[model samples]
Target: MNHDRSNRVCPVENAGGLDNGIRKFLQNPRKILSPYVKAGMTVLDVGCGPGVFSIEMARMVGTSGRVIAADLQDGMLEIVKRKIKGTEAEKIVGIHKCLSDRIGVTDKVDFALAFYMVHEVPDQASFFKELHEILKPNGSLLIVEPKVHVSRSGFEEMLKLVRSLHFEVAERPKVFFSRVAMLRRLA
Candidate 1:
């Protein structure tokens, strides 16, 4: 968890402040998405804010799989990019700037995560559709949105959206101040 707090556009505490050990403690993301992620599976971290979990995911996917760290802010992405630049791990990770909620994930990725950032999205329906399209067969999309700042109705709306797309709620972790919405694309 390496991050510089200089960029404060979101007012949300830097997502990368949780230390390495602490990150391991929160590795329950696997439990949330479960068997979908293995040692060699391509992953997408949408709205990767500052690459906190993206770093952890790189370790999970190991040397075989690739993790694409994407966000709308180049400033924040640059911070995370520099934090992990020039290393063996760099080969397994990539960064991108996409604001259209298009996702841009290819058929290779097995997992996608939007950690505590989905509700802030300008259009939930559009984002969910894009996620459903990019994921491979049976691919998983784990959405963790703040239950406090975000509306309950919106979460329900997403639930409906995912279900309509044939995605099921695979798991839901008990996240503090937030609710985890894990959905899996039908195989």
Candidate 2:
């Protein structure tokens, strides 16, 4: 439960102009996640910075499913709350303010997405352990980090931690300028 917050991206930067069209073009939620997500599945979007992917996930999950959009910053969650104000997605998406140690999610999830945000976490091992607990048996977690920020060695270290937690690598999807790994919890 280490709370080292030095490298975390500030809430203000979470709303930067770069998060608009350019970011969406490169990291389209539907294109990147369609392979793993299905209808009626509860999904968790960790470090969901402005509802960019959360909104799309809500749609992908449809009316029967749920998308927990969790972030450390209240401002970030506020942005997501505003984005889904009057849409159908609003009914399925839940905005959660998470802490550095705990994600604060009790419901078991079918899938989880951690995009470009794992590097910002202070304690990787503890984070993964919490994820393992919340995810259903055989559930999948997709972790994508910025190549520019996380080096090959760093990413490998992260993978080693995940493996130690008994998560097996299911696939390595090619994401533009990102190092990606999809892992599944052991039953």
Candidate 3:
């Protein structure tokens, strides 16, 4: 619960830009997540704007798996609900409204995706700590920040905090216009 309100959270009004074809072409969710996600695995899409990554995650996880689409804005969650309605993904994707101070999810996830949204977090230490708590032992968290927003030094600072929290660097994946880090929770 260490979230601070000073950070800029994406408004629901601009959500359309987050889930469009142009973005999909540049940052295809399936290609970015296929290595980490699997059928029957429980996953999390943090700051899932308009369910872009959440919808794709639902497909990757299959019917036996679950994709938690957690966001602070109810408008964003509503968009996710609408996108999944009447689809097979409806049963696989769960929408959760995150608390201002924390993620507020109780279930431990096998994998978590933080795409282009970590820069929006005000208290990253607390944020990463909470993520550490919710990830199963050896579980992976893929953190992707927009290169346009987060500088190399800023991303290094984030990695320092991530390491201090007992998460090890799994790898650095190449992503279009993004600085990516795959972290694994220690057992």
Give all candidates' CA lDDT scores. Answer: 0.71, 0.88, 0.89
Please write out the lDDT profile of model 3 over residues 33-104, one tens digit for every residue: 999999999999999989889999899999999999999999999999998999999999999988877998
Model 2: how far residue 18 lies from native, Å: 5.2
| Top-scoring candidate (lDDT) | 3
What is the clash count for each candidate, in the order shown?
A: 0, 0, 0
Residue-level lDDT of model 2, residues 140-165, one tens digit each, is 99999888788888888889889999
**Structure candidate 2, residue pairs in collision:** none
Show pairs that collide, candidate 3: none
Q: Which stretches of candidate 3 lie over 4 Å from their true place?
A: 1-6
Off by over 4 Å in 1: 1-36
Task: List per-candidate RMSD values in Å.
Answer: 5.8, 2.3, 2.4
Query: Clash number for model 1?
Result: 0
Of the candidates numbered 2 and 3, which has the greater TM-score value? Answer: 3
Q: Which of candidates 2 and 3 is the stronger one according to lDDT?
A: 3
Compared with the true structure, what per-residue lDDT tens digits does model 1 show for residues 51-99? 7777778878989988888887777778678878887669888887776
List the lowest-lDDT window of 10 residues for candidate 1.
1-10
lDDT for residue 116 in candidate 2, whole number 0-100 = 78
